[model samples]
Target: MTTHLRPTDLRYLRLVRASAWYDLVVTAGFATPWTYALLHDALSALGRAWGLGTLPPLDPIQTLYANLMGSVVVVWAVLRLARPLPLHGLLDGTARALFTGWQAYALTQGAPRFLWLFLAVEATFAVLQLAPWYSPFRRPAVRE
Candidate 1:
């Protein structure tokens, strides 16, 4: 496949790459056992201080599932960053939109205030991945 990337496409790709890196770090924090506990404890303390309800501890099964998902996201991000395909941006953007929407809704249902910060990051990355797709002047996709 030959990608005739315009300047905007290059910019979008860069944004995606950065977002991938950010996700890698954030996901790692969740997937790692020690860091996960630390983060949970910290948030719980903060919530208690702020008079919000404390975060619940994750069960073993939930931890396993979260780690598996984190591993998959890492692999997908690496592959997409290495190739920068239009489909990558499309799929990632769509997934991010759904995930962000779900997260925002969950936040409304009594999640921690800090979750909003993560939501903002996800929404920004989703826009970066989607804007080029909806641009009037985008080059057509050509599959070989």
Candidate 2:
């Protein structure tokens, strides 16, 4: 079957696909043991600077699992973004939004203040990913 995508849809696909590279970099950083330590150290310093005291140690198994999950997300996003599909952004955006919301709640309840920075970044990207769907100027829906 042939598909005729609007210009905006094509633009969105390109944007999201390009973003997958950034996600891969970030996911790998968090997934790799050595790189994760760097992130942990930076987060510890941020916490100390914010007067939150030393950060707790990460459980190795949990961290590894979390990294694996992130890696999976990266792969999923890459696959979804590879095509000029209109709704693919929904999955990535929703995932980020939900995760960010949970982290925001946790931060308020006692997660390190430093996590706020990460949450901010996540929220920003989530908005960007989801915005096209909600845009007033978006072209008519793609017919499958």
Candidate 3:
């Protein structure tokens, strides 16, 4: 693949960084047990306010998994924020696809209606990052 980045590549890089920033901001708060508790409660309250069912009470295992996911995603987000590249966008989009899939699966399992919001965002980003227009192969080859 071509490493000769183009203007369009720069635009895609921005999208990658932007998505990473979003993930960092949103998931950072879940990296700890205490923060996860707060987030859970806040989400639960928001669900009620919106007429959606409340989330289940936070348990130790749930907290542990949440913290793990948050920590990993936060670290990955920081990587893209600091050194974003087209490849990063492709990989992040791949991860977002997986996330969207799992989120949809959860909903099908009767998780919550509020989850649709997250799924929408995930799927949108995934589509944008993975869009065929950004494929390096489609760009005019750079003459060395």
Root-mean-square deviation (CA) per prediction: 5.0, 5.5, 3.8
In order of appearance, the predictions have TM-scores of 0.75, 0.69, 0.88
What's the residue-level lDDT of 85 in candidate 2?
55
By TM-score, is 2 or 3 better? 3
Residue pairs whose backbone atoms clash in candidate 3: none
What TM-score would candidate 3 get against the native? 0.88
TM-score of 2: 0.69
Q: What lDDT does the true structure give each of the candidates?
A: 0.74, 0.70, 0.87
**Clashing pairs in model 2, backbone N/Cα/C closer than 3 A:** none
Q: Candidates ranked by lDDT, best first?
A: 3, 1, 2
Top-scoring candidate (lDDT): 3
The digit string of per-residue lDDT tens for model 1 on 24-132 reads: 7777656666667776787779888877667768677766666676778878778876876667777888889998998899888988777777799888888777766
lDDT of 2 by residue, 1-144 (tens): 433333355666775676666677667667667777777777788789888755578779857866786768667766865663556666777788998999889887888777777688778768777876664634566599
Q: Which stretches of candidate 2 lie over 4 Å from their true place?
A: 1-8, 49-54, 80-84, 135-144
Ranking by TM-score: 3, 1, 2
Model 2: lDDT equals 0.70
lDDT score for candidate 3 against the true structure:
0.87
